[model samples]
Target: MRLFLPLVITFICGIVMILHFFIPHRPISTIGDGLTDWYMIVASAAIFLGAANLVQVHVHRINTKARNWKYSPVVLIGFIAMMATGLLWGVEETLPFDYMFQTMIVPMGATMFSLLAFFVASAAFRAFRASNWRATLLLASAFIVMLGRVPIGGMIWKQIPIISEWMMQVPNMAGQRAVMIGAALGVVATSLRMIFGIERSYLGGAD
Candidate 1:
């Protein structure tokens, strides 16, 4: 009965959304809008639940003295501080929330990304090794693309930028469109499967 009810709701909502896109009639549109509002409410509730779950897990870690448990307190403190400041003063400009976000969060995010650049470079170096013809081609293309973005490429050869632009606009765009089309087709197939109740994995157990 639990699974049946969820499947029924999924089918109804899926059908309604599909109809909403095609029909665009007044009643269907109204129902679709209401469903969207309900979805937002549910999403907000899910986020709250997720935050609670995070706190629970971290508290358990701290209590158990698990590996790296010392970081758990930092996580909890940051979460509580952010929540308190936002709830108390609101997140407007010049407020405590905004001040902390800009001063602390932004710099932390930038530092994380800066560290990621080294990882990316390491991965690229490994992947771009000219082991074969295909690898050589990939390495060459990546090199041209990277060099084209910098001033040194133009200084070395004026045509580098032009070739890079063509590679991006032509081959790269084609690949992107192919991937997008494939993804859209996959989404449609999955949605149809869910609508037909053929996909029951979302209900928790195996389909």
Candidate 2:
């Protein structure tokens, strides 16, 4: 019942959400917005689950005397500090959060985002060789995009903008639609598996 109910709800919600985009009718639009607002509230409530899991994992590691367990201390302290700063000092002060946010969290988040650049470059280098016709085309497309985006490339080659525009309009649109179709199929398959009780990884494993 637990599994069946959520799956049915997800399928119905997905249909409503998709239709809401095209229909533009009052009732369907209202239902879609309500579903979205409900999601936000539920998501806020569910964050406690993530916070609880983090504490549990870190505490266990510390208790077991794991190597470099000191990071857990930093995590715990930071979590508590942020919580207290928000709950205690609050919006009136605004100093603590702004200080920590601007100096610590923002930089850390930006650095984490920056790390993706290196990973993407590595992936591109490995996967984007011209060993075949398809690979060669993909590599050519990516090269045009890279050159079009950068100032020096634009300076050196004035035609980059025109090529980039066509690439975005034609190839990108085709790729996007293909990706969306594949993704939709995957979603339907997973939802079906959940509905049929075939996928219970979320309920935690085989007993």
Candidate 3:
């Protein structure tokens, strides 16, 4: 009954939402908007549940003295501190929440990305080996793009920047559009499968 009810609701909602786009009738549009608001409420609840689960898991790890458990308390402290700050001060620009986000979170994120750059460069070096014609072409394109971005590139060859720009606008854009279309089609297929109850994995073994 639990699985059946959800599947029915999913099918009905999906149909209504799809129709709402084409029909454009007042009541159908109102229903679609109301469903969207309901979705927001459900999403907020899910986030709250997820946060609670995170804290629970961390606290259990700390109590058990598990491996690398020392970090669990830090996670808890940061979570609580952020929650308290937001609740008390409001997340205004002058508030502690905003200050911590700007000073602490932003720098940490930037540092993480900086570290990732080295790993990405290592991977690119491995991938750009010129064993095959395709690999050679890719290596050349990457070299041109990287060189074009710096002052030394223009010093070596004035046309490097123009070639790099053309490659990005033409080949890069075509590849990106192809990838996006494939992803959109996949999403549509998955949504349809769910609406038809063919994808019951989401129902927690209800299959």
Off by over 4 Å in 3: 204-207
**lDDT for each residue of candidate 1 in 1-207, tens digit (9 for 90 to 100):** 888899999999999999999988899999999999999999998998999999999999999999999999999999999999999999999999999999999999999989998999899989999999999999999999989989999999999999999999999999999999999999999999999899998788467
Model 2: residues >4 Å from true position, as ranges? 1-39, 92-94, 150-160, 185-207
Backbone clashes (count) for model 1? 0
| 10 residues in a row with least lDDT, candidate 3 | 198-207
Who wins the TM-score comparison?
Answer: 1
Output candidate 2 Cα RMSD. Answer: 4.5
Comparing 1 with 2 on TM-score, the higher-scoring candidate is 1
TM-scores of all predicted structures: 0.91, 0.69, 0.86
Candidate 3 lDDT, tens digit per residue, 1-207?
878888899899998898888987888999998999999999998998999999999999999999999999999999999999999999999799999999999999999989998999899989999999999999999999989889888899999988888889999999999999999999999989988889989888456
Number of backbone collisions per candidate = 0, 0, 0
Residue 7 error, candidate 3, Å: 1.3
The models' CA-based lDDT, in order, is 0.96, 0.84, 0.93
lDDT of 3: 0.93
Q: What's the CA error at residue 152 for candidate 1, in Å?
A: 3.1
- The positional error of residue 66 in candidate 3, measured at the CA in angstroms, is 1.8
